[model samples]
Target: MKLISTSNYEKLSQQAGEEIISRIKRNPTLNLGLATGSTPTGLYQELIKDHKQHKTSYKEINTFNLDEYIGISKKDRNSYHYFMCEHLFEHIDIPLDQTHIPDGTAKDLDEECSRYEQFINEHGGIDLQILGIGQNGHIGFNEPGTPFDSRTHIIDLAESTRKANSRFFESLDDVPKQAITMGIASIMDSKEIFLLVSGASKAKALATLMNGDVREDFPASALKNHGNVTIFADKDATALL
Candidate 1:
């Protein structure tokens, strides 16, 4: 695991975005795994700026998002689908068909999970996976206690997660209680992983990830077992380190 600490959020985003752009330049057809939430918003914005200024094209890139809220339609403003379109996809040159996100509203969710796993495999696995660690150390909604060997599947969102996400909704009741997320095993399959963490709110989690033991109780710790994992964290997020 490699760690890169930035002075602030903007530097963190720039550092992460530069690495991604570098990779995309080296491999235009890269299969990129994406994560959502506030942590990655800045990085996405930086990518948008690069697309406009440097013409770094994503036209041949294949993107697979990390998760989506269950029962939400793609058109829902709160959906990851909508979030990606608004934040990055619509602004870039990536073909809409090249981007893939799990269908959280699929009638046969179990089959959808299997299909998602199969799709990743058929694409030769993700060349690089982007991740954002939750305050509780959850990764891609794979909350604490989730088995490290699990696959893409539906999960009951943790209460703390729901509470944290409430800011995006009018009320806690409006936040979806369930989601479909790529499991720890699925994430570990990536050839390389980039974890972006920012803010004082995540300091404790970042400390734990850096100093604590690798255990299923903290899902993000699974990355320790991966051969190539880089962490781009802002000073506030690494203060506890």
Candidate 2:
């Protein structure tokens, strides 16, 4: 595990973007794992800017998103599918067919989870995965107490998570109660992991991740067991560290 602290969110995003862009250039066929939420929006913007300014091609890139709300339609504005499209997919040169996100509305969600896991295995797993630590240390909706060895599966969103996400919806009740997320084991399969932590709200979580023991109670701590994980955090997020 490596920690790179920056003065602010923009600087962290820029550094992360440059690294990702360099990786894409070196391996155009990179299997990229993506994350949603406010933390990564700046990084996505940086990618978009570079794609336009330097013509960094994503044409051969294959992207797999982290999670999606279980009860939302893909077209729903609140859905992770729509979030990815709006924030990154629509702006990139990557083929839509090559970008994979779990079907949240699948009739049999368990089957969908299994299929998605199989699909990732077929692609040789993710070369690099982007992650954002939740205020409660969740990763990809794998909330606190999620088993570290778990595979792709459905999870009941923690109440705190729902409350935090309420800002994106009209009300707390509008947030989905459950989601399908790539499990900790699935995430650990990635060749490398890029974790982004910003804002004072996440300072305690980041501190715990940096100094606490490995345990299921803090999902993000699972990364500590991985050989290749880099954390790009801003000063605010690292204050407690």
Clash pairs, model 1 backbone: none
TM-score of 2: 0.99
List candidate 2 segments past 4 Å from native: none
What does the lDDT come to for candidate 1? Answer: 0.96
Each prediction's TM-score versus the true structure: 0.99, 0.99
Clashes of each: 0, 0
Give per-residue CA lDDT, model 2, range 86-149, as digits (tens).
9999998989999999999999999999999999999999999999989999999999999999
Put down candidate 1 lDDT per residue, 90-134, tens digits, no spaces. Answer: 999999999999999999999999999999999999999999999
RMSD for all candidates, in order, please.
0.5, 0.5
